[model samples]
Target: MKFTRAICIALVIVLVSSLDLTSAAVEEEIKVACVQTELIPCFVAAFIGSQPSAECCGKLKEQQSCLCGYIQNPTFGQFIKNSQNVFTASWHLEKMIIHVNLTQDNPMPLEAGRTVDLTYSVNWIPTDITFARRFDVYLDYPFFEHQIHWFSIFNSFMMVIFLTGLVSMILMRTLRNDYAKYAREDDDLESLERDVNEESGWKLVHGDVFRPPRGLVLLSAVVGTGAQLALLVLLVILMAIIGTLYVGRGAIVTTFIVCYALTSFISGYVSGGMYSRSGGKHWIKCMILTASLFPFLCFGIGFILNTIAIFYGSLAAIPFGTMVVVFVIWGFISFPLALLGTVVGRNWSGAPNNPCRVKTIPRPIPEKKWYLTPSVVSLMGGLLPFGSIFIEMYFVFTSFWNYKVYYVYGFMLLVFLILVVVTVCVTIVGTYFLLNAENYHWQWTSFFSAASTAVYVYLYSIYYYYVKTKMFGFFQTSFYFGYTLMFCLGLGILCGAVGFLGSNLFVRRIYRNIKCD
Candidate 1:
């Protein structure tokens, strides 16, 4: 449960993937005119922290063609480094060339031909440096598979398997009353006393089945988030297929925001419809409750994190401009969409069907010892969603790490489909079991079920640490956690929302199906 809370917090953080893009021709075009001066390459020690002189910067910029040659020449081979080993050209000037500062006082009056070492570094001045490197599409790793701290594919699968079994048991055995071996039908009963004796166990909540869930805030929050997420997934897939996504730098973002706006309507519809179905009279309250609650909670945390960063001088804001843009999109675009969704949902064709009609008493609970406990059963129900993504998530994880040239849009769309199906199935199973266990009062159960996949993700991350990543220093470690955090948050929201929606529909369906007396 605490983990779920952590995941919800993770949801609002900003993550922008930055792919390295540099080119060779672009590198070759740059030219600089340096006051050429000869020096002993042997004074390598002095050049270690030396500032780049104007002549060095000028020459490096002008004679960019010779820079690589300078580093490669045996006389100055010592300057070559692992970082400098890259063949790619940086478009940025700093990366193109290195400037060696020459001074009068500590003049390098060295032998005609000395040897030296060279390397790439950023702790240098921003003078005659030119950029090199085009694009990075290396298939390297440790980051993707190794350091992904949460939302492990394995744990997710296990949870799914457990839940699937639980669902099977509930759907097959629980309803059947252990094969109904020791039982008889109501009319087929030997006596009315016998029927009453056995029927005293589990039955549909006549009065409370339709009793509105107590936590309006939680319900609204779940509905709103689910609506937003369902929209997000649908949009991501549609955009991916329509060639709108992956077409440019911000296409995905644009698509996300647009889809999110469009989804406000769904959120309104679902929440309003659910509230209406549950017999709640205040539809306006429900609409406002959800539309405001989740966004506020998410953005509130985002603000807190950003404030901390700002206090520590560590970038605590999402850029004033971005926030303004987000606000405009949410207010102007998304709100109206939500209002329409509410209207549609209120007039929903199916919600009016009355799921929890006060009907005949449901079959009683079995007297036999059940193998599955409610917790185990509910947990098991959540695992299916994870199973759906196990293979696909691995590829996505790898693609990001190895810097692989991933352009398979169709494949991603397929994975997204799989994720949705899995999430829905899991949610349905979980809600069903919870409903059976007579825990309908807890509205957040299904939400936690779906989001629990993050546990497996975290486990895998730990495993990857020992088996994959070799980065041990603070800076590298920071980067590792940073990227993995983004991944966890993204996956968390996805799974959670799926579970929530699935459970909502499942409960409503089951409540409606049983014939009321």
Candidate 2:
């Protein structure tokens, strides 16, 4: 256990150090002009094939004096000289004439109230890579408008805080009263007599609650995969939150893939440990499933998407060599690491102790009230989490569909924290009620309860595609819904793990602390 923890800590330190260095290098190397900043709106309008706003035209006029100087700079000249590579601007005005000259002595003239369609492009040339190509910037009309969602985010956060405080107050008060009542019974004989007459609440199902869940192997595998992904996502976002990981479009995907691959060991260890603790002997099978299931699913979908992009002759298609590299990374590097982790997990950690011993004969559970039923509780459990992020979801959806630059990692990190808190709290409260109602089958229920939030996320995507976005065409539709499915799959796993682990800890702690026979 100590070795594993040390390895994880070392990996984190390395990633953070490298990221900080990379950020410093970028800041030192990249140079931008003051007038060029004004051209930002023009670039967005150009990229999205929209009419430049008056503000954009105004900036263009203001920067006319520096046009010649900008033309001399390689960074700026590349865009001006290679219109085909830089952007595809469409002229859609009734009467307009434009002049282009790199050696003109006089400054360029810009007239106000004239509309010009322009596309802007930005490319990231990594210090390590030599090849360079123009990358299109696809922000939508009225650039930088998405940042205004900060108000909605603020409102949502306040509401979440209020709800969290309310829940905390209620839980604390109720648990305190329960603890006091249990403490009042000083003698075991008195407690036994009281228990015989009217024993109630969560303690009533103590023995059954800790019984290894049915299909324990599969549950362990799922939770293990979820746990690994949760950690991976947290790390990735932390890097972004520190302003290190969001440099380019490629950087985001590259970082996530690398992190996901490296974290396979976590998946294997968690799954194997969980399976072993659950009294399962098929540790190898569990490890394999944990390693393969999510990766295969993601890769299969990506392969299909790449094939479609290639068929359409789209530049978005990933190259065959790239595909091979990705395959090797997963198959050779990640899978082997997972195997090693499984071995370590099996040997390093002995079986975990359950709060209550499982009986050879399972206790029969009483019928549950409708409100306490798994289906109802699961549905409600998901609502709070989904609600917490719904506001941020709008901005994210806009960024994906409208080709907006998503630079709000700080806001995203805040929303992520809120989602975690909400998922944990709701699941714990729901699980408590279920146990109190004598229902001990919380393995899948705890998972599905939290995962159900993804159902709402998908539904919102459908609504966005049909109502909010003007995206049309077979390719657009396919990409939107397909990627949405992948996103939901990941979200479900991350949130579900948070919920289950939180509730599991809560249940064990409460049962262990209580004065129960």
Candidate 3:
């Protein structure tokens, strides 16, 4: 750590010494001016495009000494790695030159409202890559505007607002009805279930609905698998924020794999517990599913993408070295988590079904067509989560594989939070709606709702690839679809799992809140 600090200090000294005289003079007559922004990357990208803008150039020159410092600092590093690798390769720039001495009479060029300081333009040649092309940018106002930023933010936010409103309204209504029925059953505390059974004619789920799924083990496995995926994302994000992994680079992949492998414990635990609650009997299948599915899916997709990347000269084949690491990780790490979850689950007794006294049962199924059918509700269920992501997902797809930088982690985090809310609300509403419709078996409703988003995502990707992307061809198409599907499905499932967890907690809590008789 000390050595790294020393190197940084030395670099700063070099930078300051190199820029002092020229920068001071240029500051007054700015060549490349920088716009103010909270994020460092925004400053850089705008400044780059600002090159043709004399004001921007002046600012860049003035700041040359400090550029290295900015690079060293964590906040600004994201911008450097993210700007301009894709469609706008030949966009105009507004770069600054630090030390160009400007005479008082020879004033630096200025924008309409902004002043230009001393700056110099340098010949920035593009790298010799077969696919990507680049040319020098003219420093102009046109370059300073970052189009994608607004496009994504607007698109993403709108979706969130709509979805959140709709989902929330539906769930709240369901809760109200459930509460009413629950209140009605307040008299018969001891035989609440029996009273409910007597009072109602149409309960969504009958006695068989509560039957312990035959394969307790297999149910546990699915739960575990889903849990592993859940942990993988949380750990990756936390690690990135903690600086253990660089989000800008491909270290995200490694972080995900490691986190996923490690999270087998969470998967096993959650899956087993949920299954037990559902009265599932099979536990061994749960273990196998928990351990095997994730590794196999990841390995298969990674290999496919790697092969496609190889054919296109975009990446080398997955090294045998990586394969060894993968095997080691899966064999040693994940298996234990599954085993541990199973052991814990078996040792731990299941919760009694009657956490809350059943206040009321069902009313006669009035032979009336319902406004919301399970299938329709299930389909609509995905809209909330999908809305939360479509705008951001659109940008992400364009950014990845297309070689663009997405530096808006702050905004992404905001969307993520919003997405979580939307998913839960959707699940709760769907589950409630189904139950109210006399179709009470909604265990899978949580998963299905979130999974619905994946459908929209896949469709959107298809449209973007065919319509928006100009440079990519058939192989890119195939590779794109393959990986995109992986992302959407995984994301869908993750969202669904989150919804399920949240709904389960909600349902249990509500069920526990009231007295039956």
Candidate 4:
């Protein structure tokens, strides 16, 4: 039966080739040619058993007279005659239907040289649905809107509320006491000296707290890039909510590229202000690094993925023209905006604003408990933030990997805001602890603490790959993890920068009220 169907399909191909159905219109006077051209649609309808379009049916009715004549010709008649038991066609009330009847009750044995009939049918049923809504059938609303999903969102929201309250309590109760004690105006020198000696924790490191962090240049660049990415992600998500960007092919990617270029100034302004305030001497290098850091990282990943795709002959490979266009966009638009932003930032808000004057000699960082160490603090800082967004990550992963359409942008927006708030709160708390441990190097520690959220997310992705998804093979696994790595990298940097900036402000505000020499 399969062999018989193959022969019939081959015959249809041969017939289509002989007719030379070009895009040129078939004149009414050339009846044979017109019928042959119209038959192209019928051939497709019969071959694939799909519903015939209005155009296909209209052409069939107009050229109905010439169809029989062409089919009966000696050259084409033999194949049609051989396949007559397997193929049948009829038209009724402007509808074209092809039916192939096979006797299924009496199963035929498959043997070489035995002719078995193949049966199939094509029925064109009218539908009122518009062309734009053809994809509605594929959307699984129940799965997306399940009770578990809503519960997860609510759970995350509660976590945010809890974290917010905790942060507020720390600021109001703990900080207020510290402020009152630090701001005491004692007239007696001996009492003042006693109080100074009693001060232990954050106050002891005031002079060194605001000193420039190590690796000032690289830190500034990543922070700047992370700032740009944060803004870019927020803008893209809002646009997706407003524009239904998921409906169009490559729309999200195009929007990301364009928006990233337009938002380059954010990175430049941020990196520039940070570098200048830190007294960094390499201005040009800072500006360049801020501009190229994220883009180059993505480009390197994309280049590897594209090479793998090309090797596999997959359409996923990015064309060379697209690469050139992306490079041109960065070079012409993104790079210059970053440069302009850097200049503006350097001249505007780049002044040093440290509340405490740095001492001449660097303070030696004393050893603390294992839990209070920077590495431990950084690693532990991400837990609450990750918990806040863990469920959202599952939805996102399903949409990207499991072929589900993600339309819950409102949920996403809420989750994103929650992640940001939780990250900031958690990192600020971690920074406070580190400072209390007399660790003056809170800048990078704060950044890493917040950035550690991405580490958890990446680890979750690995677990999801092995358990939740059925993804296998080197090509698919590599692409999945590679893309996840890129996402986590950006996420880590964005969260890290947010954490550091929050800690920076907290440190500045608290110290501003104290008597720093």
For model 1 the local lDDT of residue 85 reads 21
Name the runs in model 2 displaced over 4 angstroms.
1-148, 159-171, 180-200, 243-246
**In model 3, what is the error at residue 291, expressed in angstroms?**
1.3
lDDT of 3 by residue, 1-517 (tens): 3323443333333333234243333332222232232233323423322322444334444343233122222343221212111111211232212111111122223123332232322233343332211111111223222585566557766766775677667546644565566567355666666646544322324432334434445444555566567667656666555563433356777777777777777777777676666656566676677677656776788788787767654434677788898889878987887778766765574764744433244334333245556567667888757766776776677667566554445556666777777777768767665655565445565566766888888888888888877645656667778788788768766776777677667656555544433
Task: Assess candidate 1 and give its lDDT.
Answer: 0.51
Q: Is candidate 1 or candidate 3 better by lDDT?
A: 3
Compute each candidate's TM-score over C-alphas: 0.59, 0.69, 0.62, 0.78
Q: Please, what are the lDDT tens digits per residue for candidate 2 over residues 230-336?
A: 88888888888776454375888888889988998887887777777677888878778878888788877787887877775555778889888888998988899
lDDT of 2 at 509: 78
* Backbone clash count for every predicted candidate, in the order shown: 52, 4, 49, 0
TM-score of 4: 0.78
The lDDT for every candidate, in the order shown, is 0.51, 0.68, 0.56, 0.76
How far in Å is the alpha carbon of 301 misplaced in model 1?
5.2
Highest-lDDT candidate: 4
Arranged by TM-score with the best first, the candidates are 4, 2, 3, 1
Model 2 weakest 10-residue run by lDDT: 95-104
**Model 2, residue 326: displacement in angstroms?**
0.8
lDDT of each residue in 390-471, candidate 1, tens digit only? 5565566555554454445565565566566667666676565455554444346666677767656655666665566566
Rank order by lDDT, top first?
4, 2, 3, 1
